[model samples]
Target: MPRFAANLSMMYTEHDFLDRFAAAAADGFQAVEYLFPYAYDATELRRRLDDHGLKQVLFNAPPGDWESGERGIAALPGREAEFRSGIDRALEYARALGCPRVHVMAGLVQPDAKPAEHRDTYLANLARAAEQAAAAGVDILVEPINGRDMPGYFLNRQADAHAVVQDVGASNLKVQLDLYHCQIVEGDLTATLRRDLPTGRVGHLQIAGVPDRHEPDRGELDVSHLFGVVDELGYDGWMGCEYRPRAGTSEGLGWLNDYQGENA
Candidate 1:
């Protein structure tokens, strides 16, 4: 069976950020992921992870001015400096936590900007981020978010994310394939994974129920079957549970229970 990581940012919202680590552990998760760790002291976060015996699997680099509505700055023109600074900050946390992968969000595209301009800025920023990440023995990931959830997100299509990874041409740069978003933008989950995983460009995987973004068990997508495909494809990376729980986080884990039984 594939290993799963709880997304503390989305799951375990019932508890404070620091408390979620223990909650996840108590609920049977061996690993965890979150949206951003910049708000908390890295040492404290690491201490909690150690206390809970949970590995930090993934998290995103800072999204610029989140309160002001900037999802990210990497793809926005003229914010290259800020983007690099965000990357450096992320590396600091990754180094402290021993997390291997960091996802860089591509900021929203402005109405006035051309697609080519945004793409160019994104590639340039990622190339630099990749170099920095490699030096720290870490990998950088770019995810294609569904525009419906994040309107104006620069990278929205699976093909587009793959193309950017190719254009960046860095060994440490890869795609963070979120199945929820992929299902919305591109329906052929099996085919897409089959094509992308073999190329070794996939860095990490995330899953949630489609249309509702809830726990994987109740959606249009057969998440368990998809896990089977991932196993068949020989993907050993962490798969993040990046979904909002319809009930409580632990209460909605029946899907994982079912999955574990099938695999066991």
Candidate 2:
């Protein structure tokens, strides 16, 4: 059975940020993930996880000036210094939380900038990150975000992300395959998983309803069938529920219950 982790950043919006930990545990999630953790003290975050008996699976390294619309700085030229600082901060939290993965978002490609430069910067930065993370027993992940949701975002396809992993040639570097983005950018997810999962380069998985990011069961995708495929493929990492609920967060968890109930 695929272990599911509630994305506290996207789901569990009904509660305050700190309060979401208990809510997720109360709702039967054994693990949790979120976007950023730099705002809180690592000690307090660890306390919450221990109190609720939840494991922290993943979190994003800081995306530069998120409120000002800088999605990430990993791919931006001349920002390598900032990116490294962010990774250092992220690993500090990861070590405190006992997390194994840290997601590095590729920043948007400037409209008139040279693509080759951004690509070079991204690969170099990731190589450095992987080396730094390896010492801490953590893996670095790169995800492809669809253009519609994030226009100008670099790295928008699975093949592209995989190529990056190859280019970097770091064992600790891998891809974060999000099914929602995959469905929107390239349909035929079963084929995608079949090809990618066996490579040992995909470190994490995420899902949401297609066309409108909601519960996995509510979208055009037969999430149940896809999940079964994941199991058969032998992916043992966490499946992040990265979606917006149609109604309340907990109210839209029937899909989770259906799968977990059967497995339990």
Candidate 3:
């Protein structure tokens, strides 16, 4: 069976962030991921995970001022220093939590920004981040978010992410393929997985229902079938359940039970 990690940032929102760790454990999850972990002390978050017996599977590096809509600073010219500092901070937390991967957000592109300039900046920043991550034994992940959810996001296509990984020429740098975004940007999940998974460029995976970004059961995509594909492809990494529950987090978990039965 493919290991599924609850996205604590998007799941179990009824409880406080720190409290969600126990909630995920109670929901039968052995691992968890979130958007950012800098809000709380790494030691406190580590204690919560240990208490709940949950592994920290993944989280994104600091994305600058989220409140002001600065998704990331990596691709922004002249912000290389800030971007490297963010990588250091992320690795500090990753080391404390024993996490193995960190997603490097590419940030938004200004209307006047040249595509070539942005790509160069992004690749350079990633190259630097990859070196730092390698030293800490953590992998650097770059995800392609859908444009609808995040307009002007620099990285919006899977191929682009893969190209960035290739251009950086770092073994520790890999693409974080989110199925929800992939379905939105490009259909044919099965074929995409077949082509991309074997290349060894995909480092992490995420799933959500299409159109609504809800639990996998309610989406257009057949998540159970996709899970089977993932298993067939021998992907040993965690598949993150990065979706919003249409109801409560636990109430919408029937899909997981169903998947378990089918796989069994």
Candidate 4:
């Protein structure tokens, strides 16, 4: 059976973080993922997870300056110090939350930042971050946000993200292939996963139906097909439901049950 993780940050934001986690456990998610949890008390969050018996599948690097629309700063030039500080903070939080993976958000580019310079800056900083995370037994996962959803952000493709991991030369660094973004930027999920799995490039996964960005069901891509393909390929990782619910998250969860069977 494919283990499911609720995206509490987005799907359950209406409630407090701990309360949302309890709700997710009540709804049957064995694990969970989210975009960010910097403001929440890490130890308190851990206590909630312990109470609910939930594993944190994934979470992101500290998003810098949310008011300015700067989602992440790890890739921006002239901000190496800030970026490292962010990584450290994320590691502290990850440890408290018992998380094994951290999604490095390649931040939006500056108006004058050259493409080549930006790439080099991101690679260098990620290498350092990966080295730090490696000692902590955590994998630094790079996420490629689709251009449509996040314009001007560097690193926006699975192939490109894989390349970053290769360039970093840090075994602990890997790629986070979000299916929703992949569908928009590049379809053929099965083929991509097959190609990337052997390299250990795929460290984490997220799913949402295309176009609407809702739960997977009667959508452009078949999540169960992708799940079966990954299972056959011997991939053992949590598939996180990171979609915005069309009505309620629980309503859409029936799709997964129908495809995965009640046994799952």
Candidate 5:
């Protein structure tokens, strides 16, 4: 069976972080991922994970500029220092929360940016970051967010992410296959995953329905079918539920219950 992990950051906002985590536990998830947990106390997060008996599968490196539209700078020229500092902070959180993977997002692309230059910069920085993460035994996962969702983003294709991973040539660096974005950008989910999943290119996974980007039911993705396909592919990683709730996270969770019950 494919392991299912709820992304608490998207799954809850009504309660405190720990409470939201407890809810995921009570709902029967064995692992969870979050987008940004650096602002919270690492010790507290560690305690909560321990209490809930949940594993931390993935999270993201800190954004360079949360405001003014700058997201991440891992591939930006002249920003290596900031990117490394961000990785250091993420390593601390990964240690505290027992996280095994961290996604390094290449932030927005400049309007006149050259692809070759950006790709070279991304490969160099990712190689160094992967070395640091490898020393800690944590995988550095790079993700390709869809251009439709994240306008101006530099890396927005699974092929691009896979190429960067190959260029870095580090065992610790791999691609995070996010199905929601993949469906948007490529549409042929099964074929794409089949091609990349074998290269050991995929380090982590995230999914949700496309179009509205909500729970599986609100869009075209047959998430249960997806789970089955990946399961057959022998992927033993967490499938992160990284979607915005239509109304609330709790309500959206019914989608999982429906799929799990049927697929169970």
Candidate 6:
């Protein structure tokens, strides 16, 4: 069976952030993930996870100037210092949360930005972040956000993300393969899974409905079948339910029961 982690950032928005932990756990989710944890103290967040019996599976390292429209700094030249500092902060939280992985966002590319410079900076920063993450026993992940949701984002393709991981060549560096973005960018998810999961470089996985980003049960993608594919591939990582709830977070979870493992 495919173990799932509820994404608190998108789901459980009806409740306060801290309270969302319990909301997810009550709905039968064993683990949780989110976009960032910088706004809250790690201790407080860890307390919620412990209280709710939820494992913190994944979260992103700080993205640069989020309110100002800057998505990430990992690929931005001259922001290396800030990026490295964010890695430290994320790893600190990862340790506190007992999380095994962290996603490092590659920044957007501007018309004036040099791709070569950005690529060099990204690889160097990831290599450095991977080194830092290694000592903490936490893996660093890079995700490919599709152009529709994040225009001009540096990493937009699974192939590109995998290539970046290969270039970094860090045992701890891996791809956060989000199937929603994959379907938007390059469908045939089953084939992609067959090709990529065998690589053993995919650190984490995520999913949502195609075109709408809603509950997986109603999506164009057959998420239930994909769940079986993930099982067939022997993927041991948690598949994150990173989608906006069509209705109440709990009300829409009727789909979850179909995929729940016997022990879940």
Q: Write one digit per residue (lDDT tens) for candidate 6, span 1-264.
A: 778999999999999999999999998888999999999999999999999898999999999999999999999999999998999999999999999999999989987788888999999999999999999999999999999999999999999999999998999999999999999998989999999999999999999988999998776999878988999999999899999999899998878875674326
**What value of lDDT does candidate 3 attain over all alpha carbons?**
0.93
lDDT of 1 at 195: 94
Model 3, range 113-206, lDDT digits (tens) per residue? 8999989999999999999999999999999998899999999888888998998999999999999999999989999999999999999999
- Residue 204 in candidate 6, Cα distance off native in Å: 0.5
Q: So what's the TM-score on candidate 4? A: 0.95
Best of the candidates, lDDT: 2
TM, every model: 0.98, 0.98, 0.98, 0.95, 0.96, 0.97
Give the alpha-carbon lDDT of every model: 0.92, 0.95, 0.93, 0.84, 0.86, 0.93
CA-only RMSD, every prediction? 0.9, 0.8, 0.8, 1.5, 1.3, 1.4
lDDT agreement of model 5 with the native: 0.86
Error of 4 at 39 (Å): 1.2
Clashing pairs for model 6 are none
Q: Order the candidates by lDDT, highest first — what do you get?
A: 2, 3, 6, 1, 5, 4
Error of 2 at 69 (Å): 0.4
Alpha-carbon shift of residue 182 in model 1 (angstroms): 0.5
TM-score of 5: 0.96
Model 2 segments more than 4 A misplaced: none
Q: Write the per-residue lDDT of candidate 5 for residues 1-264, one digit (tens) a residue.
A: 678898988787677877988988988888999888877899988888899998889999997888778878987888989999999999988988889898998988878988788777888889889999998889999898888879989888889888888878999999999999998888899999789888888988888878887886677888778887898899987889888788878766886787678766
Off by over 4 Å in 6: 261-264
Q: Which parts of model 3 are misplaced by more than 4 Å?
A: none
